[model samples]
Target: MRSIQALPEFHVFFNDHVVNNFNTLFISMPSSKEYYATGVSGSVHNRLFPKASFDFIHTSYSLQWLSKLLKELVDKQSLAWNKGKVSYPNSAKEVVEAYKMHFGKDIEWFFNARALEIVSLEILWFFLIPSVADSHCKCVIIAVFDLLGSALMELAVQGLVDEDKVDNCNLSIPDEIASLIESNNGDFI
Candidate 1:
């Protein structure tokens, strides 16, 4: 069994808390193996693991980064800062739709891969960015904003600021991704 979830501030904080409480075996190590990185909906299933090899899986705050919806819309402004124009958010509906499609598919693959795992109890949790709730504790919100702003500035320099686009789609919740996971698993807690 495997668990797939978003990577949110709360999730990170909670993970650390649980680790501290349980004194469990947790390794804060970077990947030593060469791993493939792609968009959320791209092909994590294949890159992260072979077919049905994992016993458990976990993803947090990572999937939201794949939301090309807002990224596509902000892409126009991204280009204004630069000169390259591969695809603008305002270019066509397909771009936005493509973003959504990729995001949805990413969610699907995450769950499907987890279902193929052999664990008996898979626990999945997630965290989302730019959360709508006011309970985020000001520190987390400010930190996330600072990080996002800095990354956007870098993207602006590289002519890739589609990340700053208008957020018309309210798809910033882990629940949406969690739903996909539950659809494939037994229960969601």
Candidate 2:
């Protein structure tokens, strides 16, 4: 960052999906003499910049979001119909497969786009030195989400939220994401 005198000045792009509040970001962003900030709004699955536009790119707590909800989960006739559950935990095999396949496609698109946008020999730092949480901690988080789903189910039972609404909803966590990043072997980073 600005503290590093050895590195050249770099442009900072604050990005999010198109609906992000850019005004708040601009107002809240730290003013720096060493770098200028630009706001870029778009999905990483699609190119948000010209080829070789950046020498560095970073993402954090982002890949957990899916590109979009999988249609198969809402389609009652589909094998992947995910009724009565919001998260994939304890879901049917078909549901897990659907989420896995969707994650694969999403991350592929992500890599493809980043591959085009970055300069050769530049750093993507996509993982950004992720700190692994222990399994028990991960389970606690998943358990929290499960409790939320259970509450929604209770509401559906009381005719508060329609049952179909619960069926169509899902939380994205992409369990296969770590493997996907490793499989790329630095080619797309």
Indicate the worst ten consecutive residues by lDDT in candidate 1: 10-19
- What TM-score does each of the candidates earn? 0.37, 0.76
lDDT of 2 by residue, 1-189 (tens): 577568777787877988999999788766665577888898867788999887777877677667888888899998888788887756777887887788788888888888888786467675521222332345655777788889999999999999888887788656665677788875654
- lDDT (Cα, tens digit) per residue for candidate 1, span 1-189: 688886533211112221242223223324583433322223333343445554445655666545244444344454223122222232234544554466567666655555554254455544555432222335454455445555555676777765334123222222244445566575422
Winner by lDDT: 2
**Alpha carbon lDDT of each predicted model:** 0.43, 0.76
Instruction: Give the distance in Å from residue 80's predicted Cα in candidate 1 to where it truly belongs.
Output: 14
- Clash count of each predicted structure: 12, 0
Candidate 1: segments with Cα more than 4 A from true spot? 1-47, 67-71, 74-101, 119-121, 124-143, 146-175, 179-189
